[model samples]
Target: MEQTQSLVLVITTVETASDAGVLSRALVGLSLAACVQIDGPITSHYRWAGEVQQSSEFRLMIKSSLSAWPELRDQIAKLHPYDEPEIIMTFIDDSSEGYRNWVIDQTT
Candidate 1:
């Protein structure tokens, strides 16, 4: 049997909502992602430059096919403005069949 249900949710953050929009558009336009949802003016606190820092940010939740992970990741790096942007990926192994199929179709 062939495997037909593999997807990934890639999460990343940027300093501005405009940055989020730019990244989202690029990913989808390149067919590297099926969907990119931006959420926030959220606050994030983390250590950077050897000091604790807090900033307002927007979060990007990218839906992509498993096979597109490498390219999508590299694209994010190329477009991101931060010195060390946050790029976290999670496997989406279970979802409604219609949704899963739609994502795979769009990305592929």
Candidate 2:
């Protein structure tokens, strides 16, 4: 195995547990992401349609690489239920070497 490149942590929230599961499975099944951690029932307070809204949502921590970002984003956009899904990708500066390598290997 080669040295692992930088990875991305994409954070997103959805309205339902079922939506979370669907998104998670799609990402992993397509090898667009190595894994997706779903942490649920979190309250989300945000602005929508010029009004502050509060909702219960499931959060997904999607793990992928820069190389996979474009496709991953497209896939998420296509499948995400919301008109404007919150798929925010953050670069990981440091991570476990073994796990990072594993993520890269699994995805691409």
Candidate 3:
């Protein structure tokens, strides 16, 4: 079996489902992500600008390799509407080898 490349699941939330769709397509089109899974109107409650706020958001789980993170992050920032968008990355170092390779291959 070939060595597995590091895979990452980048998370970001948008106010509307339409925004999620657009961002997902753009990332995949740019080869920044292999696949983007869009999930739900999740509730988010947090403090921002010294105020506690709540919002209904659509979350995107972007699958990509570690090598693509920097460009992907910048692209997300450029496209996201929120002033302080939540862009988080979680490394899936324990992921199945086949899946990891697939994500890397698709991104490349």
Candidate 3 lDDT, tens digit per residue, 9-49? Answer: 99999999999999999999999999999999999999988
lDDT (0 to 1) per candidate: 0.90, 0.90, 0.90
The clash count of every prediction, one per candidate, is: 0, 0, 0
Deviation in Å, model 3, residue 106 alpha carbon: 1.3
Candidate 2 similarity to native, TM-score: 0.93
The TM-score of predicted model 1 comes to 0.94
What CA RMSD would candidate 2 show?
2.2
TM-score of each model, paired residue for residue:
0.94, 0.93, 0.91
Candidate 2, residues 1-108: lDDT per residue as tens digits? Answer: 223477999988999999999999999999999999999899999899999999999999999987888899999999999999998999888889898989898788
Q: Model 2 misses residue 75 by how many Å? A: 0.7
Q: Whole-model lDDT, candidate 3?
A: 0.90
C-alpha lDDT of candidate 2 relative to the true structure = 0.90
